[model samples]
Target: MSSSTPADAGSKPAGPLSGILVVSIDQAVAGPLCAMRLADAGARVIKIEAEDGDRARDYDKAMGSTSAAFGWLNRGKESVVLNLKDPGDLALVKAMLARADVFVQNLAPGASDRLGLGAAQLTKEFPRLVVVDIMGYGRETSYASKRAYDMLVQSESGICAVTGTPEVPSKVGISIADIGTGTNAYAAVLEALFERERTGRGQALEVAMFDCMAEWMSLPLLHFDYMGVETARFGLSHASVYPYRPYHCADGDIVVSIQSTAEWVRFCTTVLRSPEFAKDPRFIDNWARVQNRDALDEAIHAVFTPHSCAEMIERLEAGQIAWARVSTLHDLSVHPALRRIPVEMPGGEMAEMPRPAGRIVASGAKVPPLGADTARIRAEFAGAAPAAAKQA
Candidate 1:
C-alpha cells in the first residue's frame, strides 16, 4: 500500500478467467483463498459474509486495520452481508448465484444440504454453475462432521509426525491444510471451467483438507507402505540424508545440503578443510555418511562453528555447495527475491504485501472493508439502479 510499491501500472491483465463471475459464501482461509486466486486471475468474486462479518476479520490486528490473514486472501473482491437465516437475505444470495458462473463454499458437513445450498442442489438447479465444496474430511470419512483446524488436520494427516524434533512432534508453523485445500479447490474450479467450455455444462467439485494433506504425505506413505520404513523426526535435518542440518557459525546459521557425491566431496574438502573426509571409509558415500550421521555432523559442526556465517557462505559459494542462510521474517520482508504488491486496506489505508504465487500479471487488488458493498449488492441484485459502488 505504500508508495514504495507502485500501483496503477496499467489496466489489470485480461487474464484467462476474464468475464467470469464467482459468487462465494465463504469464511476463514480455505474458501477465501480459493476465491482470492480466482479474483487474481481476473474473475469477479462476490464474497458473502454473515451480518456479523467473518470472524477472521478479528483473528488479529497484524495488518494495522484488518486481520493480516483476511486482507491477504480477500483482495480484489466485493463484500456483501447476507443473513442466510433470513428469507429475504437468503433470496439475495440465491439470486446472485443464479447469475454466477461459479459457486464456492466451505461450510460444515451436510450444512450446505440442510440450507439447500449444497453442490448437488446448486449444480442441478444451475446447470452452468461450477459448484465447489470444501470440507475438513472426505464426504465418506467417518469424522466428516468433526471440526478441523490446521493443526488438527496436520496431526491427523501425518505432517506432525515428521515436522519437529525427535523429543516431540510438532505441527507446521503455517496452515498448510487450509491452504492446500484452497489451492486444490481453486485448481478444480479452473478445470471444471475448462470442461464446461467444451461440454456446455458445469460440474460439482469437492476438496477436503484431510485429503489434500494426505496426498502431500505420499512420499512418507510410500516409504512406510513399500519399504517398511517409518521415518523418524530429524528436527531440522533430513530423516534419511546425512549432513543436511544447519550449522551454527560465528555470527548466524546456515544449512548446506550435500545432495550428490561430488557436492559432499567438495563440501568436505573446501568447506570442512579436510580432504581426507571425502575419502574416509566412514563418510565416503551418502549411505556411509547416513549410517554414521552423528559422526559426520560432529565433524562438520567442528569445522563450521569456528567460522563466521559470512565466511562460510563465501566458501560455500566458491565451492559450489548448495546452501542457504536461515532467514527470519525481518529478512524476508525486504528480501531481494520477494515481490510485493500495493494493497488498499479495509479503511483505505495503504500497505504493501507479498504478491500471490503464479505468473499471472494483474492489478487493482483491493482489500474490502466488511460489508462495504452490502447496500450496493442489494440494489443491483434486486434489479434496482446500480449504486456508486464498484462491481467486483
Candidate 2:
C-alpha cells in the first residue's frame, strides 16, 4: 500500500493500513462511518464534501461547534470541498482516485453514474482500485429509487414489528439501520482488500441499508415463514425465552435470564428459595413457563418485590444466574467498565468518548473542519502525475 503524497510518512498514526489511500465522496452516518473506520486503521482518507458540506455537520451544534454525529464519525481525516457538477472538480476527483487504494461513495441513486464516478466506471478506469457504493437498497430492486432513512428503513424491514410494547410498534431509539450498514460496509471493504491481495485485481461492491436490516430480521422472518408464528413485541424482554425479563425489586429493577433447565432449577432453589416451585407442572419446561409467564411473573414478584436490587443480585451471583441492572443513561455515563479515548473536536476543544471495540487508537486525533484541507489538497493533486498503481 502507498499514498499519493510523501506527507503520509509520519502524519498518519501507525497501524495495519498505514500508507493506504482512501478517497471518499460521502455524507451522513453510514458512509462517513465506513470512511472513519478506514482512517482509524491508518489509511489516509480524503473526504470530499459539497460546498455547503455534509448535511450531518448541520444536524445539530451539540459539540460546541460541530454536530455530535459529524464530530464522532469524521475524526482523523482530511476534508476537501468539491462540486462534482464542475468538470474541473470531477476531474480532480478522478485524479485522486487514480492514486487511491479505495473509493467509497454514498451518493443518491443515479447520482454517481451521472458524474461518471460509479463503481463500474471507476473499477474499469483504475483496475487496482477497490470501489464501494453504499445506498438505501440494491440497485436491482424496485425500492432502489425510493429514499431511505434510518427510521424508514427500520419500519420497512419489519424491525419495528418486533420492538417496543405489544400495544405499539417502535423503531429503535438509535440509528441502528445506519450503524449496522456502516459496520457492514467497513467489513465488506476489508474483505475486498484481502481478495485484491490474492487475485491481483480490484472489484466493485455495494452495501444497501435495507439489505443489512433485512438480514438482521432473519430469525423473525424464519419463525413467521416456517412455524406460522408471529414473534411478539416484548418491551425490554426476550420474545421467545422464558424467565428472561426484568423484575421490579424494592429499590430498582434487574433482568434475569434462564436458558436451561439447570439454570431454572438453580434459580428456583437459590434465587427464589422455592425448590418445590421448580417442579410445578405449569412451569416445568421453557415452553410451559413461557405459556404461563403471567403466573410465573406473579410468583417471582412475590419474592423480589420485598427485596432490594442488591439483595436479589447477591442471590443471583450465588446461584450463578445471568443478571443485569436496567441501567439508565446516567448510570451508563458513570459506568465503571466503559473505556474512553481523548479526541480533538473541529474547534480544537478536547473531548472524551467511548473507545471502539477491538482497536487501540492513539489519543488526540482531530476531526477535520469543513474544507479544512481543500487548498492544500488542490495544490497537491492539481495537474500532478498519478501515483503508480499497486501490484498484487
Candidate 3:
C-alpha cells in the first residue's frame, strides 16, 4: 500500500480537474461521495463539516478509528469544521465560495436557504460558480420536505417492489439511492463546468435521490404503465427472462443468461448437450420460454443439479455463454479482476480498496481527520471574510 498526507493547498494530483476548486458543505454518503469524485479528478476539495463532523464519521470504526463510510468517500480532500449558525464561520464559508469553481451540499431540504448558502443565492453571488443541491425529493413536489434516507427513497420509488423474493419486498442491501444520487450530482457538476467554459457562466443544479431512483426504475415503471405488467420479484431469477437465472449445481450455483436465439442454440447444444431442446415448440423464442418458465426451470435443473460447478463452467466457456458464479463476499475479496488502490486513512495507516471504474485515482491520496485543515483554512480566508451576517 502507498501513503501520502492530505493534499495541501499548494499540491494537487494532475488530472483534467487539476486547477478546479471545490467547496462542499457536505455530509453522509451522497454529498461526500460527489465531492470525492471531484477530488479523484484532481479538484482541490475543501469539505466543510459541522463542529461534530459528518454523522457518518460515527457510523462505525471499521477502518481503525475512522468509519468505513467516511474513509471510503473522503480521500484526497481537506476537512474544515465550521458552525454555519455562527456569523464568523458563515462568513468564512462565503469567502471560500467566492473563489470556488463548484459548490456541493446535501443538507436537509431548506437548510441551505436558512444558512444563505442555497444554490440560488450562491450562483447569484458567484456568477462563475457551479452550485449543486442534493436533495431527497425534487423541491417542486409535496414530498420535498419529507425525510428520505436510502431505504425510504428506495421504497418510495418502488425499487423494493421489484426486488427480493416473491413473498417479500426488500430494499437493496447497498445504499443504491445515495450512490446513484451522488453519481448523478457529480455528472451534473461536470456538465455545469463544461457549460461554464462555453458560456463563461455557471449554473445552479438540483439532484434528487428520489429522482435518481425513479430513473433507475424506468424498465419496471414502463412495463406497468404501458403494458399492464407488474414486474414480479424473482429472488435470484429474472422476472421476464427465462434461463437468465442461477441453477443449483453439485457444489454451488452459477447464473446463466441466454439473450438471443444464437446464444440459446449454443446453450442447448453445447452446455446442456441437448441440441433437440433448442427446437422445442414451447421454448422456441424468448416470449415462449418466459411463458413456460416452470418447465424450462425443471429442464435446466435436471441438467445442472447433476453436474459440478466446474464442469458446467467449462461447458459454458466452450459455448461462449455469459455466466457467473453466485459469488460471496469472500469470493469477491480474492477476485482476479478486482483492482485495488492504496489509500492513506485518517490515522496515517495505509489501506487498499477496489478502484473506481474509468478513473485513475492517485494511489497515495489521504483521508483527512476531522477538522484536520480547519486552522490553516481559517487563517487563509480570515482577511477575505466579509462583515458578519451581512451576506449570510
Question: TM-score of the candidate numbered 2?
Answer: 0.96
Q: What tens-digit string does per-residue lDDT give for candidate 1 at 1-392?
A: 00110122245455667778888888889999999898888777789998788778989988878998998888888888888888878777777776778889988778889888988877777777788998898888798889888889999999999989989999988899999999999999989988987987888898999999999999889989998989789888988777788998988889989899889888877888899999999998887887798888888888888989989998999889888877899989879999988888898777787877775435557888888888877876785222112111
Q: For candidate 3, what is the lDDT?
A: 0.88
Clashing pairs in 1: 1-351, 1-352
Model 2, 242-323: lDDT tens per residue?
A: 9999999999899999999999999999999999989999999998998798899999999999999999999999999999
Instruction: Name the lDDT value of residue 5 in candidate 1.
Output: 9
- The digit string of per-residue lDDT tens for model 3 on 1-392 reads 00122335545667778778888988889999999999999888899988889999989988896988999999989999999999989988888777678889998889999999988878778787789999999999999998789999999999999999999999999999999999999999999988888988888999999999999999889989999989989998887777899999999999999999999999999998999989999899997998898899999999999899999999999999999988899999999999999998899878887899998787678999999999988887776744222222
lDDT of each: 0.82, 0.89, 0.88
- Higher-ranked by lDDT: 1 or 2: 2
The CA root-mean-square deviation of candidate 3, after full C-alpha superposition on the true structure, stands at: 3.7
Ranking by lDDT: 2, 3, 1
lDDT of 2: 0.89
> Which candidate model has the greater TM-score, 2 or 3?
2
> Which candidate leads the pack in TM-score?
2
